[model samples]
Target: MRAVRRPELRLPELRPYDGAELEPEGDYDGLEFAGTDCSGQSARGARFMDCALRRCALDETVLSRARIIGSVLSGVRGVGTDLSQAMLRDVEVSDARLGGVQLHGAALERVVVRGGKIDFLNLRKAKLRDVAFEGCVLVEADFGGAELERVTFDDCTLARVDFSAARMKDVDLRGAAAVDIARGIDRLAGAVISPAQLMDLAPAFAAQVGVRVE
Candidate 1:
């Protein structure tokens, strides 16, 4: 297994952010930023707690080293968003389009991503615990060198998803609608899947060991 490239996220003392300009190292708690256009905004090292960000256009937004907790993000379009080294906990994101999102070295706990399209999501070297991706389409999502514990994919499409060098424990894919292990199928030794999924992945599994089915 390869070593994970972890980021050193050191946030200073947070103050209040009023969503006026580019505020770094600010704290935004219990705010309702619904139906707002916060595109191209930079909120590095900000802490958001119990916030509601529904129908917000956050395209190309920078949220590096930020911490978001107990937030609900529905119908948010965050294409090309950068969330590197961020920490998200107890957050529910639904009906969002987060293509080309960067989440390298981030930590996610008790997060639920439902009914969304997250193509080209970069989660390299991230830590995910008790995360559920339900009814989502993750095309070409990269999880290389990520640490996953108790992560589940429920009725989701994982087409061309990469799991190379990922450390997975108690990861469940029984409810996945489509599974495409683009790389590192051998490294998923501790993953749990249903027998039906196993049957569906038999060809890939056979090809991995250089076995010929006659």
Candidate 2:
């Protein structure tokens, strides 16, 4: 019964940017861009509604195809922020210090990323639905070919997280404390982990199915 690849955000009926200087196709509504700097701004196709961006710097900002609704990005210090094909709905990114944030083909719905320290966050081919990354510190976060649904990674610290060719459904890392999967463990087929994260990833799934657990 796989039918929850949601992300068709439609929030572009705005005319209230009220700018203090953020003008590259700008259409921001209900704006409150506190401490705005918008470093190296491009902001292509920008359309943010209900916006509240505090401590904003947005270094190397591009925001391609942007469309953020109900946004609230606090402590924003976006480094290499491209946000390719962006469409984040109901977003709430707190304590942000986005590093290498490209987000290729991005389309996250109901996103909530708290206590962020995102390092190398690419999200290649992204399409995450109902995303939740609490207490994040995602180092080397790639997520190649990503398409995760109902994504959850609470208390995260996932070091060297690549997940190559990812297509995880109902993805949850069981309140992740320390997940160090550098590449795809068979793309984490139908991911929904518990049981102590499958016994702490069972020695990297028994060395990728060549089991010899003596």
Regions more than 4 Å wrong, model 2:
8-12, 16-37, 40-58, 61-67, 70-79, 82-87, 90-99, 102-107, 110-127, 130-141, 144-147, 150-161, 164-167, 170-182, 191-207, 211-214
Tell me the lDDT of candidate 2: 0.81
Prediction 1 global C-alpha lDDT: 0.84
Residue 203 lDDT in candidate 2: 83
lDDT of each: 0.84, 0.81
What would the per-residue lDDT of candidate 2 be over residues 78-113, giving only the tens digit for each residue?
689898888988788888988998988889887888
TM-score of each: 0.89, 0.35
How well is each residue in 166-199 modelled by candidate 1, as lDDT tens digits?
Answer: 9998888888999998987877877888898888
How many Å off is the CA of 171 in candidate 2? 7.7
Best by lDDT: 1
